[model samples]
Target: MRADIHIDSDLLQQCRKGSSKAFRELVEQLKRPAYYHALSLTGHSDDAMDVSQEAFARAWQNMSSYNPSQPFYPWYYTILRRVALNHLRSRSRRREDIDNGQIDTMLTEAGGPGEDCQSVQYSNLVQQALMHLSIEDREILCLKDMHDHSYRELADIVGVPIGTVMSRLYAARQRFRQLMKESGYEHE
Candidate 1:
């Protein structure tokens, strides 16, 4: 096992014993990546934050089920992904149309730098294109690129084989590139 995995196991052991410091360390380590994964899956910051929080709560409640011999991220991310997917499915009434207006509102509320006109335009374009993608594709891309998971790790999180992970990642990247090219954002 990797050194980090060993350290994670130690943390998990402490957490299982109800050590608050260990729980804080575990949450601090996993939170940002989990949030990013949720955001990429849900495409809404508010939903992602809520999902991440819920996932952590669930994880803490189910800490006994966590296998210390395995990696922690896949187990943690599985919870976040499920929560986000559930949230998406519950709103299936509004599935067909890509809500650009809501996405714009979300991006604005995220409160990043939009003062530079070019940056704002670029951010808007990226947001629109991301919204155009199916949630599944976005989730795959986010797990692979944004979360920097290995194919095996992604497969474990998404409950697929490594071959499927590779194929889907390839296809999703190609599609994202195609969308960027179609939007005239590709450089020569």
Candidate 2:
């Protein structure tokens, strides 16, 4: 097996033995990937953080059920993705009932200028484009590009066939390129 997979197996074994330190190490190793995956799905930092944390908590609780031979990140990410989707659903419901006062409050809270305005602007634009994508499209992009997972790994993680992963990835890239072109970005 690959070095990363070997390390992951070891960490998972440690976690299954109820070692808090091992669990912490696992979290440290997985957190950034999990957070990025969540962000790619939710298009919001707060939601990503919440989803990532919830995923880890659930993983900790269910550590005993983890199969050491399996890849850990995919298992963890599946949980994070589910949490993010649930959060999006809840947000959609709340949005229907949002009042003018709440809207104004949110705007005010978000109005502060940041130091790296250009980076923030770019990030926001990318996030907006991602938000326009279908969930499957967003997930394909996140798993293949952001997380550097292989198509086979993605298929396993998403419970889909490899052909489906390839098709979704192709469609997602085409849509993302279209979105970028529409937004005045030069698409290759």
Candidate 3:
């Protein structure tokens, strides 16, 4: 599920007023979703944790710039996305090599071909295709598809217009479908 929280303006005001407790509450509400989002971007649990924490640290340091009128998570997501992209750039590598052994293990762990096997296989195929996609494509897909962010939320988090979000998400999905086809997996 999307990592959503009702961050009331009073909480933001308290945080802006140097209330450590309030900021901690904010962190507590967001940390899990932030980490999982980071994981989808970074593909490594440790890097995901580090990226999410660093983003939070940056967000806290720049709290004064936050506008109370705007929703908090989208703003926070902007920070997190930048940190994750920066992390990806610095690493200069992508984990695109999910070998057969790993895939076999993953499939085996799901048990023999049952009623849900096709769904499991499709899910794995999509995930594997995502790993091979550009960060931009993966980010857009993950935010829109996986996290269920609306176009407005995506536009805010991506610093783009709503039309741009629509276009980007469409293009990303096209690429994803092509990748899945190339991988010999097709779903209607």
Work out the TM-score per prediction. Answer: 0.77, 0.75, 0.85
Please give the ranking of all candidate structures by TM-score, highest first, separated by commas. Answer: 3, 1, 2
Instruction: For residues 1-188, write the lDDT of model 2, one tens digit per residue.
Output: 11132345666788999999999998887777677677667666667788899989998998888877777766776777788888888788332232222112111334556536665555555655666778779878867875578878888778789999999899899999889778877745
| Predicted candidate 1 versus true structure: per-residue lDDT over 1-188, tens digit per residue | 11121235677899988787898898887776666677777777677789899998998988889887777777777787788889889867364554454445434544565467866776677677777778878778766665567777778778889999899889887888788778878746
Measured by C-alpha RMSD in angstroms, how accurate is candidate 1? 4.6
lDDT per residue (tens digit) for residues 7-69 in model 3: 878889999888889999999989987987887777666778899999999999999999888
TM-score of 3: 0.85
lDDT of each: 0.73, 0.71, 0.80
Off by over 4 Å in 1: 1-7, 93-119, 181-187
Best prediction by lDDT: 3
Report model 2's TM-score to 2 decimal places.
Answer: 0.75
Q: After superposition on all CA atoms, what RMSD does each candidate show versus the true structure?
A: 4.6, 6.5, 3.8
Candidate 3, residue 133: the lDDT equals 83
Top candidate by TM-score: 3
Q: What is the lDDT of residue 32 in candidate 3?
A: 81
